[model samples]
Target: MTKRSEVHWRVSEFESGQPFIVMEQYAGDELDLFKKFIGFDLPDGTSLDEAKQIRDLLSRKLIRVSET
Candidate 1:
């Protein structure tokens, strides 16, 4: 009934049906973060909303680093 439960079920289904695709997704996210240092853009499937979410999260950081 909870969202966590739903996500667990979906992950289980994914693991059972096509583990390779899920592995690829995890790898891709890691690669994306690494590529950020070189100014590589987010993947094509990333939406404006997601970009806004990432920007909002990054802007909230209080560390005051110039990397962003």
Candidate 2:
């Protein structure tokens, strides 16, 4: 039998009202063997460019947090 691993994440909004995502936990025997994926869907009034900007900003912030 083969075993699979899982990763958990949380999404929340900043004080400024921007949304961000963070890794909450992982439950698996092999963290290296697991693949991670993330997705974002633009809201009804949001444009593609605005969505991209938000995604980029969130990514950068997360990266900074991870580095610290």
Candidate 3:
């Protein structure tokens, strides 16, 4: 599929662990509408500075932020 979609990340927690969520949503597409977010794990030794950097990187790669 040669389709492109905007994406964003939201910080979320599941149970007692913090997870980063990557969400992708189609803007205007027929018969191919899809929305999903997959959580990422911050493994041991991941520092706050690193997480912040990742967050910033995601922000730069995003088209816009949307609440779900």
Candidate 4:
């Protein structure tokens, strides 16, 4: 991920067995991002590392927006 990046993870059955969109996880302050993800009501037992991984994966999957 780059500066000012975010992990916009949509809830998928494959990822979290849900059918909803996870909020955009702004880059920096990863701890805060994870806290937000947890609040989204992810499947029970989702760990901090799992949340981080989800964000990392999303940061890669999404298209890179050029910083103006």
Candidate 5:
């Protein structure tokens, strides 16, 4: 028996020039997996301060997810 568990994270950009973070989870087999989006869309000319805040939030979410 194989006990498999994994989590994948990625960033994707759309043609409209917005970026979003995607998270995927896998257990046992590729067929048994789930995906979710963080819903933080960054557009062109985003402010540095705002970017920093988003980064912090993303880090927190990543940490929480990794703990599961």
Candidate 6:
């Protein structure tokens, strides 16, 4: 099996009513599964930070659909 190296974010929004942040309309066959987040477990840690960093670094060289 092969893993997808790209992902497209269809929608990125913040919901105050929810406990966890949700990335809706994300489209990726396999890469999504391999993606690692730094703050997934930390309540104070911002997951968006990791996402943003990756976006900044890869957007110019690769395809990374990111939203902060």
Off by over 4 Å in 2: 1-36, 64-68
Evaluated at residue 51, the lDDT of candidate 6 is 47
| Per-model TM-score versus the true fold | 0.34, 0.35, 0.51, 0.36, 0.38, 0.26
- List candidate 5 segments past 4 Å from native: 1-5, 26-68
Worst ten in a row by lDDT for model 6: 16-25
Model 4 stretches astray by more than 4 angstroms:
1-22, 25-40, 64-68
* Most accurate candidate by lDDT: 3
Tell how far residue 26 is off in model 5, in angstroms.
4.7
- Tens-place lDDT digits, model 6, residues 1-68: 55444543221224532123222224555454445642222244446665455445544454634432
Ranked by TM-score, the better of candidates 3 and 5 is: 3
Off by over 4 Å in 3: 26-36, 45-53, 62-68
Task: Summarize candidate 2's per-residue lDDT along 39-59 as a digit string, tens digits.
Answer: 344455554456557656755
Give model 2 RMSD, 1 decimal: 10.8
Model 5's alpha-carbon lDDT is: 0.52
| TM-score-based ranking | 3, 5, 4, 2, 1, 6
**TM-score attained by model 1:** 0.34
For model 2, what is the alpha-carbon lDDT of residue 25?
Answer: 25
> Looking at candidate 5, what is the lDDT of residue 52?
60
Worst 10 residues of 3 by lDDT: 28-37
**Which residue pairs show backbone clashes in model 6?**
none
How far residue 52's Cα lies from its native spot in candidate 6, in Å, is 7.0
Looking at model 4, the pairs that clash are 5-27
**Would you list the C-alpha lDDT of every candidate in the order shown?**
0.29, 0.46, 0.54, 0.51, 0.52, 0.40
RMSD of each: 16.7, 10.8, 5.9, 9.5, 6.2, 8.5
Order of models, best lDDT first: 3, 5, 4, 2, 6, 1
Candidate 4 lDDT by residue in tens digits, 1-68: 33344445654433544433365654643443355443255566666567667756765787332232
